[model samples]
Target: MVAPPIVTLLASLVHPAAGVLVGLGIGVAGGVALLVQTGTQPPLAPARSAASPARERLPLGLVGIVAVFATIGGVFGSFNVAAIATAEASGAGAASGLLLSAYSIGSVLTGVVVGAARLPGGPRSRFLVAGAVFGVVVPVLVLAGSLPVLIALAFVAGLATSPLLITGSSLVESIAPRRRLTEALAWPPTGVALGATAGSTLSGLAVEALGPQSGFLVTAGSAALGAVLTLATVLFLRGRAASADAGSTR
Candidate 1:
């Protein structure tokens, strides 16, 4: 959503392909700046032992589940494209930006709400619920008849994103081996990068082959898949907790 506007603006002045190049340039610059900033930061304290987690390290099953949800998060980028196309097709090109803005607004609100009030659930459970909610909301985008309505749906769909993201990372942090905390955190974004590439390509295809409205189903499906994985994670964790409890009693 953020890069597209820059691409469009630059493309109008240059070539479409060149716009992508420029966007990439900007991204590289920003990334380098971020790296420099982070590299300069000092460690808070001397290293210490990790809290005794449910495991020594994250289970492969848990890693896979987190990756699945991260992919669902990445699919939101595809939704922005599909939404923009739909808006332009409807002859309200001027309002197309609102779709992105509305979605972002929802994410911002999530940070605020999550910070201000505690939601009742672990990060994993909340992540599952958020994924499911977005799954249901994304499909409903097809039913939107006006630009405003589409924006509203986009906003609602975005409500789940940051919460899922924050919780997913927290879950990873909680389970990550002490020696590999940074490595564990890296997987979520890696999953996001792979998913975004695949999602944008597939979303473009779906829009071309299935029509813009139907293209949205891809994103919905991705979220639903994540929700399913999250549900399995929840069940697995519950079983572990129960087993641990029974053993303690014995």
Candidate 2:
């Protein structure tokens, strides 16, 4: 009795660390790629104001990119907490390994599609909306009491997790200044840490009170929140014309 609740809470708090670490590794890789692309020393310096307008935009652009990333990390970390709490309550805690695998699967699927298709802003918005829809769907599956359904949901959930994140990372790369790209990448990892901690702690308590199914419901709600945030980010980015311009004056 006590074990389930304790485990549920502990899982919620701890599991996000896994994702945060994964995201940080990805950010570092991206920074390396950018470094290689530009043939510049990888440093966390701000761009000089006297540089070209595009160049000057780099530092602020990085900040914008970091903003998008923090949103992604926070959303996904919330999902992880929910997944862990629900699994613990359902006596499926041992099976929770599927969550990470599922997330990876989702990320790969999204990466392939995004990289392959050169979509405009409108299409990209649709893509993010679709991800949000998946976010809503996956937790609902977990709330249902079918083992097979939950397994399938795991894969779908994983897929959703990756694409949403990749889009955010891509945005950061596109807009952040060359000088601050490395540091901008660092922001996502820190955000992931904070997100993971909050999501886990909350989900643990929620599961303790309401049960596993309700815990999943809460998870679904958080996913919806993430979806809404992604949509808002898309709209904000679109309205601003470009990330560089939006963050330039700051």
Candidate 3:
């Protein structure tokens, strides 16, 4: 079935007042839910002092990295055409959509591959790195601008997203206290939303002030920062594990 035009319908139905009231009501309800969930049993166990946690506090780190990636995804996903809009490229918007879709398709395929394959150092560590590298590298390749290269980069960048997301979610499930699991789970999505909103809002100013070339550079920097953050998270997790092991041996 075709979806209703919710935005248009809502505009018609809520002459601003209804819209404000409806949004406020939803916000209030969501706040109540958050309070309820926070006070209840969380999903994680009481963190063991010397025992290895199935998931460490990787989510806290991954959330930042993935949110930046998600921002890039959203920028390339929706604003590519507008960002590149010039006499030479009138169809940039359409191209952006196609490119973002290709990127997403790559991510889905990669998730299947990573999920099924048993690689050394394991999926979380290996794939998280892979995802971060892809996040950094893709923007560089896109700036270089050969169609085949862009396509490949897009796919690789897209493929990396799922692993980052999966690992981030797993970390949330494994590390968060049972009472606060829902809040933990919400972080990545919240980051994604914030990132995308910021990217979309600022990208226009970036392109106007710095040009399209520099816009990619800014995005690349964001992606690189994300990678560094991810690596830092891994290091933090490893350090925690090592300390736990040493304590146990002592």
TM-scores, each model vs. reference: 0.77, 0.62, 0.61
Where does candidate 3 have its weakest 10-residue lDDT segment?
1-10
Off by over 4 Å in 1: 1-26, 34-57, 241-250
Candidate 3 lDDT for residue 93: 33
Clash-forming residue pairs, model 1: none
Superposed Cα deviation of residue 83, candidate 3 (Å):
6.2
Best by lDDT: 1
Error of 3 at 87 (Å): 9.7
Q: Between prediction 2 and prediction 3, which has the larger lDDT? A: 2
Per-residue error at 183 for model 2, in Å? 2.3
Point out the higher-scoring one by TM-score: 1 or 3.
1
Give the distance in Å from residue 156's predicted Cα in candidate 1 to where it truly belongs: 1.4
**What is the lDDT of every predicted structure here?**
0.70, 0.58, 0.55
User: Number of clashing residue pairs in every model?
Assistant: 0, 9, 8
Backbone clashes in candidate 3 total: 8
